[model samples]
Target: MSKKKKAKDIMPLLKDEPITEKHIGILEENLQKVPGAGKKGIEKALETLRKLKGAKKDETVNWQTYRNEELKFEFKYPKELDKQFISVVSESWPSWPPKMTIGIDATETDFMCEENPNYKDESGYGERERVKINNAIYCVTSTSGAAAGTKYVNYTYLTIKNSKFITLTFVLSYPNCSNFGEDNKLKKCEAEQKAFDPNKLADQILSTFKFISQ
Candidate 1:
């Protein structure tokens, strides 16, 4: 809406013709009406404008940190996520609910084959691959199941930090709301589920996890 404000102290200036958020929308809508070179410059300016406003679409800058002092690890999460939605368990075989949870498991077990790392319910089922997060290599697993018109998606990230195994898991249960045999309620629930992506949010949260020195 105005010139970008600097983090440092500076003098403010008045504008002869101020641009508003509505003007941005109008420009975006009519971008195709402009010629090729003109359109490119306008697009670049819009990108800079968005950066100056310190805003990104569908992204949150304010995040809360979760630290485990004894385990020597920490991660961040968006403040909009209720703390009640997260849990941590430190056990040999940690069980996960159909929700968000992070775990540090340092179990002494030989059941898992070193080559595959498949361990009963703890390991991911379908798509398994290696991914690098925060400069650390992690194995990712994707598992899915469905029951009674509801679908469950489980994404698990596993890695070893400081000789201890760590897991960052996100489970999404779609259309969890009970429709009670009503068409309108079912439609509303399905619409909500289709509008949001669980995996993208999982990636954002999982990337914040980092191991600290003991």
Candidate 2:
């Protein structure tokens, strides 16, 4: 008599097959049910599925890539983000075109990112936190202020890459998320702001940044 087809038996058949998050979820749900060798096989497949998910996300975005051969670094960003040069505009003075950018500077700065006593204003450089992104840990310094009643924000991502200390700076300026009168009537701000959120975009781009040589 032949044995029943188990998950381990089906895993080999999944080779080169496109797996979705739903498929991954199902596998994770059943992972505990299987024991021994079958369990190990599913665990390995789950890891592959997760990597495939990340690859699929990158493919769907079709973001533009920026590579600096001299620095051996590369990153990607969306087209909507590319056109950003907008500062919150007003009637008295038109806001200048958005100048969204990820400015980078490589220096031998301190790795600890210690706060300077001279910098009395806590808001100037709020706090330093260590975060891991793109397989590299960075000392992130975030600062924010208001300009003409608009929110002005900056992020400094400092890390050491290829034996050189590097800093990636990101800036964002956006008016408060509100609905004054889109259709001539007051309404609440839309709950979804993912499409235009610069901060979210910055994090996405940061994930794509890496040293090609490494």
Candidate 3:
């Protein structure tokens, strides 16, 4: 007796076939069963199918430019972020320092890593890596820590442009998962494993940064 064919066995045969409404309906029904299929799984599957059928690629991104006329610099950031431009002051000083900060509230996590002991000094905990963007080389360092029951991670890019030191800092917060480590650090956090990764999005925003010449 011949073995009955399974739906999985027949799926490969339709790989190159044109997608129809009926086909989409069947896929949608089974989408939840796919490995790693979560809330957006079906939508992503449909998008993939559309792309396979030669749908137009959507490369649109909404971005806003920030400029400082006196400083002679500018950069672009995603419009979706809750952002602000402000001057950072020293702990003891009330006056604004010479440096300007483009603060972005990622809002994904509630943990504030800024106050963590690991990031208390100028040079952070992580190893510095060199990154080249727009013909400029930047030294990047990242660190993560917890404060007041909140966990946070930060990346700082530093470079000298036109005889002035420039720094761009990116900070994000994540839930403290008790399932990982006693200290609840990111290295052992299982929540970080399943969480939506935002590092790529941060990189995309950083790529748009430029120092405009006066």
Going through the candidates in the order shown, the clash numbers are 0, 4, 3
The worst-scoring run of ten residues by lDDT in candidate 1 lies at 5-14
| TM-score, cand. 3 vs. native | 0.40
In candidate 1, stretches whose alpha carbon ends up further than 4 angstroms from where it belongs are 1-62, 78-139, 144-152, 159-166, 176-182, 212-214
Question: Distance from true position, residue 88, model 2, in Å?
Answer: 10
lDDT of 2 by residue, 1-214 (tens): 1112355565674566777778899878878776565676677777877886777545316876767777567777554434233333323332222222333445445456665433324446455667665466666666666665456656666666555565566555655544344642222223333345544444666666677774
Judged by lDDT against the true structure, how good is candidate 3?
0.50
Assess every candidate by TM-score.
Answer: 0.44, 0.48, 0.40
All candidates in order of TM-score, best leading: 2, 1, 3
Model 3, range 74-130, lDDT digits (tens) per residue?
A: 766554433121112223332111223443333323212223333444423544556
Q: In model 3, where do residues sit more than 4 Å from their true spots? A: 1-60, 79-124, 130-138, 159-166, 179-199, 211-214
Task: Give the number of colliding residue pairs in candidate 3.
Answer: 3
> What does candidate 3 score in Cα RMSD to the true structure?
13.6
Distance from true location, Cα of 18 in model 2, Å:
16
Query: Which window of 10 residues has the lowest lDDT sum in candidate 2?
Result: 94-103
- lDDT tens string, model 1, 1-214? 2122220111121123244576467556656666564565557556655554454333534676777777566776664433222222223224232133345554434113233444335433456666655465666676765666655656676665444666677655554556436677766665666666445555666566677787
Best model per lDDT: 2
Q: Candidate order by lDDT, highest to lowest? A: 2, 1, 3
